[model samples]
Target: MQLASFSGFIKTLFYIIAFYYIFRFLAKLFLPLIVKKVVEKAGENMYQQQQRQQQSSWQKNQNDDTVIYNTDNVKKPRETKKVGDYVDYEEID
Candidate 1:
């Protein structure tokens, strides 16, 4: 089996360091933009929810001023029973 070379080890280490720095640079460049977009989206959703609540409240306010008349209480009268009452007799032993 062949032994690992020192130059190969150095080259691998160099690649790892290079990639780490590149990743950090890209993250610094894009992280703020990503966070800002997320914040704006959350704000938009909150605004939409507030708008929906306002519309629902507006409809409720309109309904509060309206009046309804009920005729059901006057239409139905008390029902009278036509059957006679029965008396039960007990037998004495």
Candidate 2:
């Protein structure tokens, strides 16, 4: 019974080591691909954000260009005579 338990422990340890190595090997193989995909996605997102900003700015500029402020059509207020007591004071510094 002791021998059987010892064998089982050894088998478990071997499997653990084997699984660990397998995980490490697979990670090494696929880590770069995953990183590359993440980087590409980030780049695409940044590019899309820049495009949106540029499009918004361009639209704002186009809207600004279309605005027409005609001062000729605006009526000026009639000038009125000043009616008040004028007081002259000297400022002393």
Candidate 3:
């Protein structure tokens, strides 16, 4: 029969703790670079969108002709015949 040993347990525990610390150290080293790249990409996208909006507005300005319409004769609303009485619902307490 195999039995558990204290030294073996200690070794395993030490390895796990070491691996955790190393992972955290590496993340602290590289997380900022990753975040900075993401922010720069977002800024570039916003700049591109602004440029497109400006170009479209400039194109619209190039065609500034105003067309006027005459609305002197207009049709009036149709008259409705007699209908059923309206019933409004009341909320019960």
Q: For this target, which candidate reaches the highest TM-score against the unseen true structure?
A: 2
> Taking the tens digit of each residue's C-alpha lDDT, what string does model 3 give over 1-93?
988899999999999999999999999999999999999999999999999999997778778776545676777788998788899999999
TM-score-wise, the better of 2 and 3 is 2
User: In angstroms, how far off is 38's CA in candidate 2?
Assistant: 0.7
lDDT of 2 by residue, 1-49 (tens): 3455888989999999999999999999999999999999999999999
- Best lDDT among the predictions, by candidate number: 1
Show model 1 residue runs off by greater than 4 Å. 1-3, 66-93
Taking all chains together, the TM-score of candidate 2 against the true structure is 0.64
Model 2, position 77, has a per-residue lDDT of 90
Q: For every model shown, what is its TM-score relative to the native structure?
A: 0.59, 0.64, 0.56
Q: What lDDT, from 0 to 1, does candidate 2 have? A: 0.92
Per-residue error (Å), model 3, residue 90: 33
User: Candidate 2: where is the Cα deviation over 4 Å?
Assistant: 1-4, 66-93
